[model samples]
Target: GAERQVRLPLGCHHPLVPLHLHEERPSYVVCGGAVFTALSQPYLQHEWGKAWERRAPVSLVAKALNGSKAQRGEQVVLLSQLLGHECVRGYDSALLANSMVRALNGVPILCLAQLAQLVLACRQRSLRFDLEESRVLVLDTAQARGAEAEILQQHNIPEPVLINERDAALLR
Candidate 1:
């Protein structure tokens, strides 16, 4: 008798990644036992859809309103990453699409649970964290103690340095 093998589907990097690379290597995807390349990015829009797809934005708003400070910070990080912006302010400024801002009422906290869900999805599907390749800002000390710090260390991403409180105040 022959043994049957099970293969899992892994997610791919953002569609734009190929344009920036020197070589056109496929995005990193890890199947159960083996890894493979996807011919093209899979479900790019789904990354955005996780928050506003089938559900009501009001629910997200309630979640953020009731969530903790850490949750708010996480939401800001995820939104900034998604928009390819280093900071939440930048995302707000550059994002001309009013729908997203309107959906969350421009409250960054409302994006928390969606961000968490997206992160989990990426892990389960073995998707590459392309958003993280961009510059990241570590504002408060809390970020230094969480997974964000671990990711920065793992990627060798340098944290932005503030020489003094004055400089730190400018970031705020």
Candidate 2:
């Protein structure tokens, strides 16, 4: 018999892949009532509990099982949650939770850091989030900007945006 090697597709489920963590660097960004962050195994586990594979969103689970990094530093950024605010009136948070963010203001989103930068630097009248499944979330730029502080204050959040210096610098 001859010895043979087999390779399995591990994607983000690979043990060697580092999980994004807030302790290492700011893993989330709060902008215009939306909380954005990269997808991680821990997040899925936390959201769905011990039986995450059975309870988690099928799409997310598929990503975890089948997704692979396409480029260096690539991440699957998602709109993890939403905060109630006038800026986001009438939008159902449940429908948007855990939705993968594909783009913002027509610019593709690569990572949480880049998404943060885009939201902050947009000079347009509106900010548009192109999410998975052809879903769109539009917000008035001026209203979102003005309400950001109030949203944070109301929600008792200390910071509106937080990203590791290295990640931020890479974008610049």
The models' CA-based lDDT, in order, is: 0.27, 0.81
Q: Give the range where candidate 1 is weakest over 10 consecutive residues by summed lDDT.
A: 31-40
How well does candidate 1 match the true structure in TM-score terms?
0.17
Residue 125 of model 1 has an lDDT of 20
Instruction: Give the Å error, residue 15, model 2.
Output: 8.2
Residues 63-156 of candidate 1 have per-residue lDDT tens digits of: 3334333321222222222222232234332322212211111123223233323333432222222222242222222322234444445444
Give candidate 2's whole-model lDDT: 0.81
Work out the TM-score per prediction: 0.17, 0.83
How large is the C-alpha RMSD of every model relative to the true structure?
20.9, 4.0
What digit string (tens of lDDT, one per residue) describes model 2 on residues 18-103? 34454565467887898887787778877998787799888888787677767656677889888998778888899999999999
By summed lDDT, which 10 consecutive residues of candidate 2 come out lowest?
11-20
Which residue pairs in candidate 2 have backbone atoms (N, alpha carbon, C) closer than 3 angstroms, thus clashing?
none
